[model samples]
Target: MPRRGNRLLVVGLVGAAALTSAMAVAALATGAEPVAAGVVCPNPVDELPAIPAGARIQVERELSALDQQVAEANERLVSTAGQGGPNFAQNAILGPLRDKRAATLERIAIAIGREADRPEGLEQFATCALLGEGEQPAPTTTTTARETTSTTAAPEQEQDDVAARIACPDPTGALPAVPQAARAEVERELANLDRQVEEANERLVSTRGQGGPNFVDNAILGPLESKRAAALDRIEIAIGRVSDQRPGGLESFAECSLG
Candidate 1:
């Protein structure tokens, strides 16, 4: 009976030793921070704080903004694609804008990926619905693209105008009158652009105000983005000139090719 009791004690000790080793392995594997040597095992979940709603919202919003930027950029590329005309300055200006926007997207992706060490975070957010989880039901691809177009079209219009204007409206030429068709197209595009901008602004406001996270990164960062903003301003001025009553020349109707 004493031998049997000793054998039972040995088995229990082995089991305890195994558990200890397993726990040690787990700690090392999961980067389990130790409170102290030979002391209490910390609760893993307690070690990390849940991402705050505000922070998450901000991060998510930034992620979306960057993604929207990328999409808009690609769209610009498409818009400018296959054109082999005198739009040399227009295309030239877009080069740097494209590169910078791409860089911004990369940085944003890196930030999203590092949150609490998540993987596929960049892609996740890129593919994630703009409104975040649940509120919109199934992930509708068509709706997302349409919404993206509607959201980004305005900023591009404004920025393109701003950029063109900043290039210093050609003092060499006088203000030209817009062609009838071009005028109609410009008006139509501007109206659509305005509607889309309003939609996007509304989305931004609603997203930020939600109990979710607040996206402050894009809250008027600085002039780096102003280059693009300038482009928008230039575009607006140019469009205004096109629609202007002044009779300068036919150059104002150059964009008539857009149609």
Candidate 2:
């Protein structure tokens, strides 16, 4: 009788192990496994104030974009796991994400301001974190890209504000009057030019401490000039479609300076 009882227990244990393995296999096959743990960002739009009816559509679009940004950032965090040093997550993924969010939030405020009072303190929503189990919530203090970079910046770099910032010529400043047909497209390209500058400045802030002396020019400003040049070409094409006189001297605006 004792031998039979031990045999039964052993069979039961084997059955349980097989069942667990089968379940795991089934989960994998069905793509039901949870994503690997990664950075989680907060949604600021959830806490947004009442949006005016005139601004509702643009506001909602920006809000949707905010969600998409977080999803992409989290995806990057998972894919680039163990790729960089301790500050890798911050400098590469989270910093750029925050800069993008800040820009988006500013757009949201501008959209709202066109119809109603502009929202204040949206900067609080910019920063994100990789929260571990039982970790404290992300800091709520409103830290701009400049302020965040300044804290860890070398003293000499901090002394010269120009070294820490970018100055790009405003492409729209010398533009000819855009025809009604080309106005919308021209405005969009102009906006892209502005976005290119904003991104370059943000990159400057995010990568302040790292890289060699020429890193800013090689990494940030050079690519910005290329992007601006492309945008300027698009603007000229947009104008050419609607007007006989395409804008000249746009190429001159492509190059940006560190200031």
Candidate 3:
């Protein structure tokens, strides 16, 4: 009988060990945090703090304000295409909007007793959605490009005017906006001429030992100088007549066409 009892005890011990290992594997597979033996895992929702009164409303309000800010910045960008480039607009406008949105998310997380260390772009407000149940949803309409011509062209023309107005310095201290198409053409020409000038300079440097002084002067420098002058003339014309005043302290764009 003693021998029989010893065998039963050994069997029970092994079974218990196998059960513990299985539990651990299951916990890991389901991403549940491991708990000490005999301890119960706490429910995640139970860990959240009780919702405070008006918390949801306040969060919604802040979100609305942030949305307005983003919208305004977008409008400004559309109105002014040459507003110091895309980086400038992002830094000056979008960055702040995103930060505010993140802060609102953090605030909501804290109110609901959740960890605020969530990854960006995945912010959630569980209770906030309830606050909008009585409100009507905003209507949305989709319009194809062909149908949007009348509406889109005006904004584009306005953007072009803004670009031209700021592209060149005003001679009489009065800036004027121009057509967007014209601005694009002018900028393109300026860029092309700028490349040509660079190529000419490179050619002049390469011709140093290949020819005599007169040959270098006539074949390379003379033609290059002429092209540079022509580019400058085109740039000036694109800049419009206002630049003829030289303005208060506007630097000469003519230098860009020079070697």
Candidate 4:
């Protein structure tokens, strides 16, 4: 009888140990924090905040409406380009459309907790470049012989002027540490700006001497220069806002490339 009682007690001890080991394994598998020796395993799902009622439906509706507006804007941009009026496509159509679309995208980012601002999603939905329409052609301008002579400059001098005008700011120490909440949207916008800079560079190279002597200056360089400047400015503002929120914020974002 004494031996049987001892055997039962040993078996009970083994069973308790096995149960504890199983609980620890389960916690680690589910990404839960390490449990203290005497603490019970926490429910990981309990850590997450509850989704607000109707939030998903509201976000979907807003996204759908924004997409419609973007489609209409693309149509208008193409139509204005086809009309062949100087500055009409850019100033009246594309500019306003880009502004509205960007604003809508920002709102969506804030609403859906920044996941919607990812590059893949923005490239698919927010970018106007994917609309399958060509850029407006530069309007023909008649130049007198004197005008041509006065306008033409040495290749080296032209390069120097371009280099001087588009001098990119050193964003190394200047970038603010983006909070986790705003990280997705800010990075998405920066990626978009980087793409624009790349496209501008490509356009500058491709359309160098295509339209006319002034084509490079009027159609390509001027607009691209403006865009690059604006992008850089906005990037600064975004970073600045984040830095203002916390100490050591600027230094924390060492990986960010503002160029």
- Candidate with top lDDT is 2
Estimate every model's Cα lDDT from 0 to 1: 0.32, 0.62, 0.36, 0.39
lDDT of 3 at 14: 12
* Clashes per candidate (backbone, < 3 Å): 23, 1, 0, 1
Query: What ranges in model 4 sit over 4 Å off?
Result: 1-167, 170-172, 210-218, 229-259
- TM, every model: 0.22, 0.41, 0.24, 0.29
Q: What is the per-residue lDDT of model 2 for residues 1-259, given as tens digits with 9 covering 90 to 100? A: 0111111000011122222322333233334543334455543432444455467567656766766677787778778987989999899988998999899889988988997788887777777666433343323322222235546787776777445578777777778888999999888998888888887787677555433343455346555666777789999999988889999888787766775
Q: RMSD of candidate 2 to the true fold?
A: 25.3
Better of 1 and 2 by lDDT: 2
Residue-by-residue lDDT tens digits, candidate 4, 1-259: 0111111000011122222433443434335555432211111111112112223344434445554554565456555555766666557655665566566555544554643322224322333322122222121121133235335867885565455322233343454566766566567756765676566566555433223333333333333434544455555556556666532332222212212
Lowest lDDT sum, 10 consecutive residues, model 2, at 5-14
Q: Which of the numbered candidates is closest to the native, going by highest TM-score?
A: 2
Error of 2 at 133 (Å): 18
Please, what are the lDDT tens digits per residue for candidate 3 over residues 1-259? Answer: 0111111000011122222332333343345564432211111121222223334344334434434444454455456556686376557555554565457556545543442232232242111110011232221111122224324457765464233211122222322353454466556665765576566566545432222223333333334434444555554465564344222222233222211
Sort all candidates by lDDT, best to worst. 2, 4, 3, 1
Q: Return whichever of 2 and 4 wins on TM-score.
A: 2
Error of 1 at 52 (Å): 26
